[model samples]
Target chain A: MNHAWNVTRMHLRYNSIWLYMPLIVLFSSFFINLIIAVLSDVPIYTGGVASVYLFMLITGLLTLRNTFSFAIGFSFRRKDYFFGTFLMVAFVSFSTTVLLALLSYVENNLTNAWGNELYFFHLPYLNDGNVVIQACVIFSLMFHLYYLGFSISSVHRRFGRYGMMILLIVSLVAGSLISAIITYFHWWQIIFTKVIAYSAFQLSWGIGLLTIFFILVSYFMLRRATS
Target chain B: MGQILEINGLTKAYKDVTSIYQMSFTLKENKIYGLLGRNGAGKTTLMHMITAQLFPTCGDVKVFGEEPYENTRVLQQICFIKESQAYPEYFQISDVFATAKSIYPNWNDGLANQLTQDFQLPLNRRIKELSRGMLSSVGIVVGLASRAPLTIFDEPYLGLDAVARGIFYDRLIEDYAEYPRTVILSTHLIDEVSQLLEHVLIIERGELLFYEDAESLRSRIYSVSGSSEVVETYMKGKEVIHVEKIGSLVTVTLLGKKEENNKKQAESLGLEYVPISLQKFVVDLTTKSREKVVKGQ
Candidate 1:
């Protein structure tokens, strides 16, 4: 366990750039939104600030691709690497969630959406809840996206580029098949109604479950991967 | 000394290709071992298995009386340096050293700094910007300074000049003597490391070819040159590994210690006997094996 923590610290040191990227993106987007609000007399909506979340997602892929082999070279066990990576991802996600929540609180209460009714950190359905709920939604979404990247990278590591391509193709085909079945059964309307009925907290919790599933699959992939 | 590593029926197969097959050996503590083999001869595969970087298809590898796979207790004592070790793109040499210091329990900061000076490696240079020789020097510094009980170097001097390689060897030998730990040096440049090795393990075509004390192996193989007819007569009933002829002159390498009577006989027969170097002996042996395989096919 100590070794695993050491591996985590190593990852934190080497890949610290990725950890700070979301904050950089958030601040840059905020500045851009502020500039547009000052120039124009209209309300500016900066909902696209979720780009920071996308950056967080990509960080997962880069971490596994770049550091997995290196950790193995240093004689870290596959399990240790996986757990260490999980710890790093969790830490980064939680920190990003808290920062985003704080920014949203400031935007809604302090700056009043940058004094021009901007919606940078505060989205419609995403932040229409208490502070804990807002943080949960962000954390769950970030975790899900990050683990999706992790699962893909784990597949690439274990099976190579060809394997990743095959996986993508298979997933696309399976998705199309499911969509076809849903259309044939005329279930789209029902599915959409059910999805709309679910509250943000419930939906985010479901996505959190998906993140756990991806984490499990990634572990299996990493077990068979070689440096 | 106790055995530091023990292997039994170790094998690693990838699909249809077996990189190592039914190999077994014991490494005693506090001795330098030379793992000598050609490319594709399974030396790297064996090292990876011992370090728990790769799994064996079938076999058991015990380091410090326990399996090394995922066992931090065993792995913490091992430091494996390879030609292709990767560092994070953003890491400078100093970052790498700091990370190594944290992971390895016995890492020596003073020794690492001393080696950085000896190898003239810049601490602030990003890993991606360093030249290949400098990268190799970084590995050497880490391997020596980590001071792990079992240190393995697999072709660790790629792109290094002769001077840098000499510094590596000198530092390795000096630190190893003071620390008294097991070291495995695997390289294609066999002659350069021959003097540093106490025991030698030779692998050929996924099989163990020979494992013995280096001195014993040196005495076991020798070459003789003379007239074709005389050399042929003298080499009869001996285990001849290689034979070459230029016009009427013939040279043959045989496996056996040179007895006094055999030398006397060769002298009387106008044959000149020469001791074969380890590098030449390995090359000749591997060449002969390859030829035999081609002929068999």
Candidate 2:
């Protein structure tokens, strides 16, 4: 257990860019929006918080190739690396969610959206529920994205780049086929209405289940991954 | 005196190509072993399997009497340094040492620091910026300072100069004598490391060719040169691994136990008998095995 934590610490030291880049993008986006609002005399609505999730997702992919291989070279078992990476990802997601929630609270209650109606953290349809529910939605979605990236990287590691390319093409064809079928049946409107019918909590729980599925897939793929 | 590693029928195959085929060996504690082989002879594959970095297609690798796959109990006792080991791009040399300190329970800070100074490794420079020789030096320092019970170096000094390589060997021998442990060094520089090896494991075309004590193996094979007729008559019914001819002179390398009677007979027969070095012996052995493989193909 101590060794696993040490591996995690080592990963955190090497990949700290993933944790800080999100905040950098967030603040940069906020300041740019603030300046635009002040100069143009107009309201700025942004969903820059999504950048944090995007960065984390990319980090998930990069770390598997970089840090995971290095850790294995250092004599860490695949299980220890998986556990350590999971701990790091979970901690980053939880902490980022809390930070985003606090910023949302301050934006909505204190600064009045930066006094120019600049909506960054408190976006509509996503933050329409209690703070805890909003945090859950963001956290689950972030985890889902991260695991999706992690699973793809694991596939690339276990199987080669050709396997990942084949997977991409297959997924694209499957998605296109599904979209074509839906379009032929004229069911896009019904799908959208059904999607909007679910509450934020229910949607988050559904995505949470998908995240678990991705996590399991990533674990199996990673188990067979070699340096 | 106890066995540190026991491998049984270990095989690794990729698609239709087998890198290692049903190899088995046992490594005793507190001894330096030389895993000598030509390129693509499965030395790295065997080391990878023992370290649990690469999985075997079939068979078992036991370290400290337990399966080493994903077992931290076994992994913590072993340190494998390869020529192609990757490092995180964001790390400095100091960060690597720090992480090694945390991972290896018996890490020696004093030794690490001393080696850092000896190797002249820049602690604050990113690993990406280091030259290839510097990178190898880092591996040597880590392998030496970690003090793991089982340390394996698979061609860990690829880009090191002769002076640096000598320093590494000297430091390795000095440290090892003070703190005895099992060490396996896999390299193609058989002559350079021949004196350092207590045991020799020679692999040819992914198969075990010989495993014996270094000193005994050195004495087992020898070459004799003389008149063609005299050498041919003397070489009758003996295992001749290699032969060379110059004009009317013939040189044949024989593989057998050294006996006083045989030496006396060769001397009395007007044949010049010369002992073959480990390097020459391995070259002869691998070349013969490769020719046999080609003939079979």
**DockQ list for all candidates:** 0.75, 0.81
In terms of TM-score, the best-performing candidate is 1
Each model: TM-score of chain B? 0.97, 0.96
CAPRI accuracy category, model 2? high
User: What are the per-residue Cα lDDT tens digits for candidate 1 across A11-124?
Assistant: 877654867666777788788888888888888776666787787678778877678778888878889889888888888889889988998899887989878878888888
- Where does model 2 exceed 4 Å of error? B260-262
Give me the overall lDDT of model 1.
0.88
Pairs that collide, model 2? none
What's the residue-level lDDT of A26 in candidate 2?
Answer: 83
- Give the TM-score comparing model 1 with the true structure, all chains together: 0.97
lDDT of each residue in A104-176, candidate 2, tens digit only: 8888889998788788889888887878988898888888888989988999988888899999999999999
The number of the candidate with the highest DockQ is 2
